[model samples]
Target: MGSDEDAVLAGPFWYGRWDETAREHHGGHARQLNRAARAAHYAEGAFDPDATRAAIAGLEIPVLILVGELDFSPSPVLATQLGELFAPGWVRLVVQPGAGHHPWLDDAARFGDVVTRWLAGS
Candidate 1:
């Protein structure tokens, strides 16, 4: 359904459509959510960056910090900080070229390549 034009049109983010109207009318509704929802929303009404950083710091596993080139949500600098929390060889950052919030969709091959290399090294 990701590429389905009709499906996309039927959603609330669209400027026109009955479904859009219904979605907008819903008391707790919004369209086109940001990707930061991945790391931020852990529980109801809670966004714990400190806890996230702490958990990250606690981990001894190698980490890959991939962010979209155009994403300004937490920003690339923030990703860098997260990477720094780990030991020197334990973290790597891969910024997808020409990408926004969703890097996998922006450049699938590059994302795959980074993951492949990280896994091979691990």
Candidate 2:
């Protein structure tokens, strides 16, 4: 899985489908240097869950938390748990069905509709 096909497979793993356009786009734009930097950032403890919860609790604005139903790095359960840290009614958590990590890439129309409707009401 270390070849170009492996890179293409990432689209399915992330978006729930083998999106050719997305794969091609990613192939064109994904730089090794940027990937290295991102890997380093994650290794450096880019997120502290306790601090994140404390910070989100202090926010007064309405928060929309969107997560893909199939995303494993931070699963739907984790997303719900994060939303629970905020005051009731302050956070709206939406788990897009059939999606992995990139919900918009998995179902662009549905994603657009969800975001548009949420924006209209917010």
Candidate 3:
């Protein structure tokens, strides 16, 4: 995330819910730092096309690509790419309006509805 967002989530004065220690230990300090270090180490710059394309093309199971309307992390356009990764007609794209990165956290009702409908269709 960018600076403002990161500050609100992690800064001492901005985080009204808890102190710095608590924030660091949201998943426990050791685990959190370990995860952060690992992520930094494996950070991406260029794509490994052959590996990525082959992995996607190899999947034969049904796939549901769900993205939030406000989430540009992976973007809704990714749904089309993901759909092509699965068997034809076996991929569904669901977008929840007004939702951000975590759609279920943003709107449980809509998220549940989508999941229920998908299960019913299956």
Best by lDDT: 2
Residue-level error in angstroms, candidate 3, position 81 = 2.7
Candidate 1 Cα outliers beyond 4 Å, as residue runs: 1-52
Per-residue lDDT tens digits for candidate 3, residues 1-122, read 45545644543322223444435534353343576766776678546778877887777766778787766656667756666766677778987887655576567788999998888885
Who is ahead in lDDT, 1 or 2?
2
Q: What TM-score does structure 1 among the candidates reach?
A: 0.57
Each model's lDDT comes to 0.64, 0.77, 0.64
Off by over 4 Å in 3: 1-47
In candidate 2, what are the lDDT values of residues 5-57, reduced to their tens digit? Answer: 77656645665665685575466645534867767777857788898878888
TM-scores, in order shown? Answer: 0.57, 0.73, 0.61
Clashing residue pairs in candidate 2 are none
Q: Order of all candidates by TM-score, from best down to worst?
A: 2, 3, 1
